[model samples]
Target: MTGTEPLEGAAPAVGAPLLEATGITKRYGRYTALDAVDLRIEAGRTVSVVGESGSGKSTLARVIIGLERPDSGSVRFRGEPVRGRRARRAFRHSVGMVFQDPYESIDPRLTIGEVVAEPLRAHGLYRRDGAARVRELLDSVGMEGVDPDAYPHRFSGGQRQRVCIARAVATDPELVICDEPTSALDVSVQAQILNLLLDLQRRRGLSYLFITHDLEVVRRISDEVDVLLRGTVVERGTAEQVTSRPQHEYTRRLLGAVPAISPRQRRIGAPLISDAPAVPDSKESTESKESKESNSA
Candidate 1:
């Protein structure tokens, strides 16, 4: 389809996958980053790709999002090939991405409002009420009181990620490709961000292609899971099926690597450490006072 034509006007046929990649292969000289990889994501669902570093998870995301082209195979969005500059541009309006490092993803020089409004402006979706839209986006992502004029450096990592998320969804894209979006956040903050993403998906009917090495995260957010090892998918199934009943040897090993505390080892309802030292017993205090008096006498 041409760029001038509203790509969103042409909807996918009923029952067709939202996005499909078939036999995608990528080579960097002799090194193969992806080997005949195939993936499909449905509407309003999460499909997680789990793998360690250099296992082609990021490569797959990039290829599907048109950041990097595969050597072979094809990426089809809404049943149309994402080919040529115009087509890729059209495809981008329907998709968005959130990167692994929130700090690195945003430009420090730009104000938060500018960063969030960028996608809207780029795709010609921004209007006279764009600033108001920016405020609404920030509020939706849990940055309600944040100053829009503030720069990226002023925000915490988690807060910056929220801004990135706001930017990603500014265009109201059908799918968001999150490439390790929570990997760099604190454990507690990770849970909050995950929840926010889930909430956004439910409210907006957005789909996610979540990429992460953490199987724990997959279990938490994924509807389907694909295990990638050495640039090849070793297993693919529902999140429950792959996590609880993994058939692949590599998948099992990956699951085993996740640290877990046994019920016996967990310290439930433990008190937080206090800054003040423990008080001495009455007997010890009396003895100390008596000793001091005797020495003075």
Candidate 2:
């Protein structure tokens, strides 16, 4: 069940775990979205779930974040079981999420500042400081230049992502789940957002469950990776081991698909290899040139 924002507020306990999920499993009809998944985050370590489309990466994230309830698993916060009324109250303040689609995830009705402060208002994260806290949140995400009053539609995709990040980090959340946070932006912009997230992590010591289809992205931010295939984890290791010495067949297949981009494919897609002159196929080019000369002769 998708959770509605919880009602009633409580003071967050002092110096406790950011978030935790253990033995998480979810099913839909005959299919399983997540099959007995075990995931953990230290105080400030990032764990990335790497997989392609429909591989249950997103489902695991949704379940862990309390967007969906697992069939039989427990989510914990600060070494306490997160399955009761008090746990739900703590979760509202302790966890924040940056969704894949920034455009749809942000409300168009609210100004960027309003959007950023929504969680703050929802959980009383900034009930006292108010606008000052909002500005600080914007600056924390490298969006201090943008006026809080501006509409989200006015911002570029990368900038929209910045707003999303600002909103996620507003409450100084101990844990943030980034769901393909850069997949919708230009390559250059993707780099900027990645850097921003890294900077924030360094400054705040925030832990993350980073999810993405991009191996290059996983390499940059992930300390460890869980390779999910058909709702099951096929491989789990450090990013270096997974990228350099893949063990699973699915992992190897994904590694093989990473194209060594040509100068052309760097601009277009991976088909630029076909457009290049090939050594064996050069015979056909030579024949065509001779044919042209004969016609001229």
Candidate 3:
């Protein structure tokens, strides 16, 4: 089968979600990392989960990817339970992950070619033309003409992230879970990586479970958004709805925190600093102090 086609028996049934989690809960000792969260992704679209740090965004990604099994609830891929060894192995082949830190995600010991080919080799997809396939994947992510034999450390942060993205799509998976994929890059580089993701999604017909703390990113990449706060989803709606007219207090706070490109571009009624006090002038302070003293007299 070609890269564009879904894997055999991996396609979802009609009207079924590509991936779904219901009432997911995870705990470590007495602390709950995830509290009864429900999320779903549709085919060929992006679903983003947005929250602050420690809000269970990564935990949800882990649970959905089977890195950590939830204490309660279930995850389904293609409308079937992701349980048992065989089922999980199959599920993994159809899902790829781009982790937050590029520096740590790739092995320093391996060459770029080997890093990208690891998934293909693991899934038994690497064959006679595997090297060429690896090169093709690298080029797709704008890494053309670089020697694949070079170690990951030789590349810049943005370059390494491009490599990570190449590896994520090497297997031509149906879904890619991006955990803060561009958070570590510089502002300009972040735009490039996000555009690459959008391009890949269009070309490969891939779905995304995009997890980020940045609401601006949600505006750019997501079709639907789920606002996660302290392990629970406080709001869910279309990307525009959640970002532009957020109803939940937590979601509004998150949007308010995003730095606008210019003061004029900031949302109407959304201040540059939310609930922040203005710097007091020395003259104004003295005048107010004198006024207070005279009033007391």
Better of 1 and 2 by TM-score: 1
Candidate 2 residue lDDT tens string, 1-297: 222122111122234445657778798987777777767677887878888898889999888777788898898877788777777777757777998877788898999999988988888666778899889888776665568999976666666777899889887788999999877765445656787787788888888999988776676678778888777777777788777777777777888776443465567754322332212133344334334423332
- The lDDT for every candidate, in the order shown, is 0.80, 0.73, 0.81
- lDDT string, candidate 1, 10-96, tens digits: 122235689999989998998888888888889998999998899899999999998888999999998899999999999999998
Among these predicted structures, which one has the highest lDDT?
3
Which residue pairs of candidate 1 clash? none
Cα displacement (Å) at residue 290, model 2: 48
Q: Give the per-residue lDDT of model 3 (tens digit) for 1-297.
A: 011111111212245689989989999987888888888898998999999999899999999999998999999998899999999999999999999988889999999999999999999999999999999998888777779899976676767788899999998999999999988765545666787788889899999999999998898688888888778887888888888888777888999898653455355543322221111123244234334423332
- Output the worst ten-in-a-row residue range by lDDT, candidate 1: 1-10
- Pairing residues by index, what is the TM-score of model 1? 0.83
In candidate 3, clashing pairs total 0
How many angstroms is residue 184 displaced in model 2 relative to the true structure, after the best TM-score fit?
A: 0.7
N/CA/C clash count, model 2: 1
| Model 3: how far residue 288 lies from native, Å | 53
